[model samples]
Target: MSNPGEIAAVIRAVLEALPVDALRAANTAAGESAERIAAATEGTGHDAPREALAHIAEGIERTGEALAGLGEIRERLNAYLAVLVPGVEAMVARPIAGPAGKRPITPPNRRHHLNSVGRKSQVREENTVILPGTDVRGDLDAIRRGEAAWLPDRDRCLVNGRLYGVEVPGTVYPDEGPGLVKLNRSEYKALKGLIEARGDMDSLPSALANNPAVTGADWQRAAEVYEHHKDYRSEDT
Candidate 1:
C-alpha cells in the first residue's frame, strides 16, 4: 500500500495537471455569447451573432462532455491504482506461499434465502442447504436451464453444485438473468483469478500477498518489499 502522504501527493499532481481554468474560460465565453445573442435577437429578426452563439454553445457542450469523460476515467484509474498499490506492497513484503495460501479473499458473510415462484412453505426452511454430491449433476442442468434463480437481494444460494451471489449489479445469474449469487470458496477464487488475469498477470502475485491468510517463507519476500518501498511514487509523464 502506498503511504497516505504519497497517495495525497499523486492526487495533488493529478489535480494540478487538470485544466480547470480553461474549462471555466470556455464556459464563461459561451455564456457571454449566449447573452449577446439574446439581446441582439430582441431588436432584429436577423442576427448573425445568434449563429455564432449557437456554435459557441455547441463547443461549450462538447468541452463539458469531454471534461466529464476525463473525470470519469481519472476516477476509475485512481480506484484501480488504490487496489493495485496495496496489493503490490503486500506482495513485496510477504513470502510466496505454495498454492495453499493462494486464494481469493472471501466476501463478507451475508444471509441468503431462496426465492420460489410458488408458496414459501414449499421452500427449504434451513438457513444453509447442502446439496448432495449426486444432485450436483442435475442441479447444474437446472441452472443451465434457468429454472433456479439466484436472488442477490436475499441470501446466497448453492445452485446446482456452485455457489453464486448478487454482490454487484449486472452479474448474470444462473437463471440467465441479472443478479448476484454465491460461489464455493474455491470456485470464487478461481473466478477472481480469471478476472484479474484478464488485465495484468503480474498483479496476481501482489494480490495474493495481500491476503491475510497467506503466510510462510514465501510471503516473507513480499513483506520485505512492502515494508521498504510502500511509499514509492513515480512522476506522471
Candidate 2:
C-alpha cells in the first residue's frame, strides 16, 4: 500500500535534489568553449574546428531544451504537491541551492534559442527587423525588452518582421501536439524501452506496470514520448 502524502514528499525531495545548477554550469562552460572555437576559426578554413564548434552549438541547444523541460516538470510537480501535501509548494518554490562558494552564472536569454532550433544564427539582435504594420508589434516589443510576457491567448504574430508563434501557457498536448508530459529522463527511457520491447509504439500500454519511475504518468505521456522519439529519429535520419 502506497500513501499519496508520502509519495508527494518523495517527489518534492527528488525535485529539490536535482543538480540543475551543475547542469547550467556545464552548459555555460560549453558556451564559452564554443565562443573560443568560433573566434579561433574565423578565417582558418579548417573543417575540424568548424565541425567541433557545430557539435558544441548543438549540445548547448539540447541542454537548454532539457532544462526548459525540467522547469516545466518542476512547476507542474509543485502544483500537484500543493493539492496532496499542502505548503510543500511554498517550500519548494525557493530557488534550489548551487555549489558552495561558486558564483552562479546568469543564463542567456532562451526565448530565441527555444524557437531557433537549427536556425540558431537567426537569433540576432532583438528588434533588428520589426514589422511596421502588425497589431502585435507593441506586444512583441514589450516581450523582447522583458518588460512583458506573451499572452497565452495570442497565437501566430509578427516579431521583427518575421512570423512567430507562442506555446500557450499550461497547454497540454493531445498525444499529437507539443511534448509536455511530466515524465523525467529515466522514465522517458523506460517508456522507450517498453516501446522497443513491444517492437512498436502502437502496442505499448498506457502505463508501465510496477514501475515507480512513472507512478504518476499516464497515457498522454506515453503517446507524447512515442511521438517525440519518432520525430527525433526522423529528423536525425
Candidate 3:
C-alpha cells in the first residue's frame, strides 16, 4: 500500500543511485578527454587533435543515448509501481505542506540529465520519418503505424531541426525503437494533454507556440465555465 509519491521517490532514488552515477562518470571521462585533446592542439595545426575531439564527441553522444534508454525504463517501472501499489491514488490526491510537493523529490541535476536524454530521443524519432521533402502524409502514416523499418537515410535528417550531419550507420532501430524512436511515457502524456486542450494534435504545437500556458489556462477556464453553467441550471431547476 505504498503511496504514489512514495513510489515515485523510490524510483527516483533507484535511478539516482546507479544509472545517474554511471552517466556522471561517463560525462566526466568525456569531458577530460575533450580537455586533453584541446590542450594538445593548442599550438599544433595537425588534424590528430581534431580527430581525437571527434572521438570524444562520439563517446559523449553514446553515453547520452544510453542515459535516455535508462530513463525510459525508470519511468515505465514507476508507472507500473503506481498501478500495483494500493492507496496510491489517495496519497497523490492529498496535498503536502510547504514546497515539498511543489519541488520534485528527484534531484534537479538528475532530472535535467534525464530530460536531455528524452529530448534527444524525440529528435531522433521525429527525424526518422521527417526527412527533407518527405511525403508528409505517408510519413505520418508510418509514424502512426509505429513502423521503424520503412525509414531510410537515417543519417540525413535534421537533429533538433538544426541540420546536424553526424550519422552512425546501421539498424537505427534498437530494441524495437526503444533508444531512438518510441516516445517516452511522459512525452506521450504531455502530447495527449496538449491535444485535449487544443481540440486536436494538429492545433497543439501552434497553440503551445502562441500561448505557452494554453493547456493550463484552457483547462481552468473550461472548469470555471462548466461550474457557472451548472449553477445556472440548478437555479432554473
Best by lDDT: 2
Q: Name the best candidate (by TM-score).
A: 2
lDDT scores of the candidates, listed in order: 0.38, 0.43, 0.37
Ordering by TM-score: 2, 3, 1
Tell me the tens digit of each residue's lDDT in model 1 across 39-155. Answer: 667767675766775676566556655555545655665665557465332111111111111332232222222211111222121222221122333533333322222323333
For candidate 1, the per-residue lDDT at 232 reads 21
Q: For all the candidates, what are their Cα RMSDs to the real structure? A: 27.1, 21.7, 21.9
Higher-scoring candidate on lDDT, 1 or 2: 2
Clashes of each: 29, 2, 0
The lDDT, on a scale of 0 to 1, for candidate 2 is 0.43
| Tens-digit lDDT track of model 3 for 1-237 | 467667667765664554544553555455555655677678788888878877766665566556556556766765675576744431222221112223322211221121223223332222211112223333222222211111122322111111112113311112111122223343333433333343333544554435544455444433332222212233244
Candidate 3: C-alpha lDDT = 0.37
Q: Weakest 10 consecutive residues, lDDT, candidate 3?
A: 157-166
Q: Estimate each model's TM-score.
A: 0.30, 0.40, 0.32
